[model samples]
Target: MAEYSLLIVEDESTLRRLLEYRLGKEYNVRTAENGVEALALLDEEIPDLIISDVMMPKMDGFALQTAVQEREDTKAIPFIFLTAKADEESRKKGQMTGVDDYITKPFDIDRLISRVNRLLERTKIFQTQLDAKIGQDFSQKLTPKTMPVVSGYTTHFYNVPKGHGGGDIFDWTETRPGTYFITIGDVMGKGLQAKFYAFSFFGYIRSTIHTMLGATDSPAALVAGVNQALVNDSTMEETFASLLLLRWEPEHNTITYANAGHCRPILVSERGAEIVTYSDIVLGLTPNSEFKDTSISMKPGSALVVYTDGVSEQVGKSDEMLGEEGIIKVVQNAYGHAEPIDAMVQGILDESKHPEFDDDVLIFWLERLTSMDRQTPRWFSPFRDVAEGS
Candidate 1:
């Protein structure tokens, strides 16, 4: 029942006006003399559907359709071609451009209206279904349902996709009691395709972790394993991903991490916030890429923060990005709050003032709790003792 907008591009004044007057009764109609004028109007506002004539003075319907298809915003709009030439060649050309319909001159007005209505309705249905599917997939696959509970540490994560879905993914597993392995990555691109690709990439990462968990505890080795798997797979040969792998060993009070072209993690302690500088090439780029691990000792009350580019690249009021420096400031400010992780996430959101992000936003915070702050029961003590060879 939503009133759809339609653009009619025809050189003939009488026929254009007649179609507009008739179509205007059921939907919003706008008329243009040729494809050039139609494109100008499109810059101001995109219509739900476009009906264009095959021949015109400045730009014809085929040329106009190509121009519209070139833009990301206007490419999906339903298009119909109207023409005096009923030749098979012209019809084939229009079809090649993916026009919704082609009607010859002396076409029935009633038939034209019916085709327009059917195309618009089909488009609406398709969009609705796509949105629903993306929403469902995002909730079920891309994000963790609950924050991880690790002994001697407070762990929290926050994620918001740009729209219905995004490319960022994060997951954690308790390799052994009191020891955790975490993986965070961003697939290259956006929207539904990126979301699905991320799922596939994460699947490979998970399988690598499970198969190698008993063999080695090195993050760099695990990252190299994942990269090799991706390079070997024909389906993922062209896919690129930035991965950050971290292993938290509470017994050692240290975090061992490896990066694959991902953003450097921020370490906040008595020395102050500083970026961890170790990095390597992204996954799926080369077959024999090597990843190096960096180990950082964490004192009680210290925290480590990792995030996707969306957080650091957020545009501020001055049209500048809130880069790593801005994120460090936010993390430092959140230290005094009862829930530092939640406060840090909120601080970034308030600073950006963006209701929706341009890319997928993800923040993962891990804080080593001081002895005085340890209130939760230690459920991993048995596993901890075994890991320590006691």
Candidate 2:
């Protein structure tokens, strides 16, 4: 259950302390001298509900209500007007301002508490519904499991939400012929906390990628920018994210990539499979952190397998983890026969064992085509063609 937070806005000192004492037992309470102080507090954090005096210096209850209702963030916060006046006109005016209830002064403490409880209960229900709707929308945004044509490469991926519903997100774009950008990240937290961070940072990265198109060839710089963006968000103090960024250049026949505390990607070819060991600090954990790039020359028919911990840490029938070494073994066994991109994934999952995943799972397979297989166009919309298949 969410612990309710109540902001009491009253200019009078005596009643403010009394309300705090009475309400603090059942809810977290904050006190403000007037509407002006309340607005200042709101800039820091919004409360679940508000109780405000009708008459006050600087800003009155009606004025505060009007201001709160004008904002998208504060509009739905349950509000109650505390007034000494009981005139019908005043009550009607309070209702017009979107006040949830009006409590007349010299009010019975018990009745006031009852009204507060009911409003809080209703607000909680409304918030849960809103969260569910928004979560569904976020799921849609993260739904792409595969991308389309990227010159001489094919891509495939999978996303499986955990029981608590975390998001393991990935995206890629070929900004120009022979140049490509790809990114994958696992968001911290679970359920609503995970959804909030997942949606928030997804937008950040999406916009950042667009802004970064053809501007620089450094994947490390983009990862550093994403890290700085997370550090700038005050709410991300306890949250951290792990991500990987990749940029492919056909002229050099090489891929430049960086990892920010994410699981390493495995490279598989006729020579065998090996994990790329590049590493850096996780995003949102360190301010002004540095991430270095690792470049690899691709052999024809080479395959790259990238996945979140949900696959690496998955428990098998015997409760053993399918760790990085296990992933290496799986790739080695299938390296010769594996297709560059398949709905089954660039790699196989059941070979890793299809155990019940305890967290969200994401796996991406990227393959550089051999000369014999390079028949497709230079580029196409990966999202429009392949995302629906997965």
Candidate 3:
């Protein structure tokens, strides 16, 4: 059986010690004399379950539960009110406060233990199901279902989500004829929570792009619009996301890109592979953040590679990470291959020596095919009205 941790907060010294001693046998337990001490302990380390008294000096159980529920880090911890108050009003208040379980005085220790076990087991099962559902949704929606076919350009992307989903997200759309807008981002966490945040953040990105259509064509302006929206939203005040936006113009053979604390993209051509040099603060940091766009000229057979940190941070067999420099090497080696994007992914997997990555892996490759190379017609239309000759 797994050893779960529990926190017991009670005013009575004898009762606190007795509960701790009994619960300690099945689980690791910590005790506190009052809500203040319980909060202090919580700051140090969050426990799986919190059993607290309703009445105590300094801070009462209701106050302590409010504090715990308000914090993002501690809000999810299961709570139980074990107190002497057995009134119907007290139980109603506990229920309103969102206590997972409530036990009155003269409670049987065996019954209490059983309730604790059931609550913990239920929480574990709920988390597992939530992760599975979120992972399925991520696989279906977070990544592009099909690569857009642009005239004079060949596009390819690969996304491998980590266990139960991860934070990486990417999207692309043709803003105008011969112009394509692409955005890649990574939310600042992992697993189901990060995946949830990624979906929300990506929604903001898409909304901003559409809201600013025809108003601005600069990548920096689009990124700034998204940042402003994120920072101004109270719910997203604590959420931070690294974003990279690119505007590709096939007729001009140029790409104008803006980075918001994201990994710099690599530009691979006949000469060699090199990283694009431009970046700014991440989104949700501040509304006043400034973003700048850098334009780079591309030649035939040239390609741009944008990816999440998962690729650059992969730990290799040497126990060292495959940093940006290693990524450049992978792109360079894969250049000119019949399937360069697949070659790059295989090279990365070979170096990592892992069947799957620890973080979500997303890679977007855009190549300006040469005249001699086979070309495909543009079949993707961003606007139905425009496609229908309206």
Name the lDDT of candidate 3: 0.88
List where candidate 2 sits over 4 angstroms from the true fold.
1-134, 212-215, 336-355, 374-390
Whichever of 1 and 2 has more lDDT, that candidate is 1
The candidate that achieves the highest lDDT relative to the unseen native structure: 3
Each model's lDDT: 0.86, 0.80, 0.88
Clashing pairs in 1: none
Per residue, candidate 1 scores C-alpha lDDT tens digits across 37-140 of 99999998999999999999999999999999999999999999999999999999999999988999999999999999999889888986886577557636
Return model 2's CA RMSD, one decimal: 9.7
Prediction RMSDs, each to the true structure: 11.5, 9.7, 9.9
Ranking the candidates on TM-score from highest down gives 3, 1, 2
**lDDT for position 285 in model 1:** 92
- Residue 360's C-alpha lDDT in candidate 3? 76
Expressed as tens digits, the lDDT of each residue in 252-367 for candidate 2 is 77889999999899998888899998799888987989999999888898888888887777765566887888778776775655443333333444544553456677778877
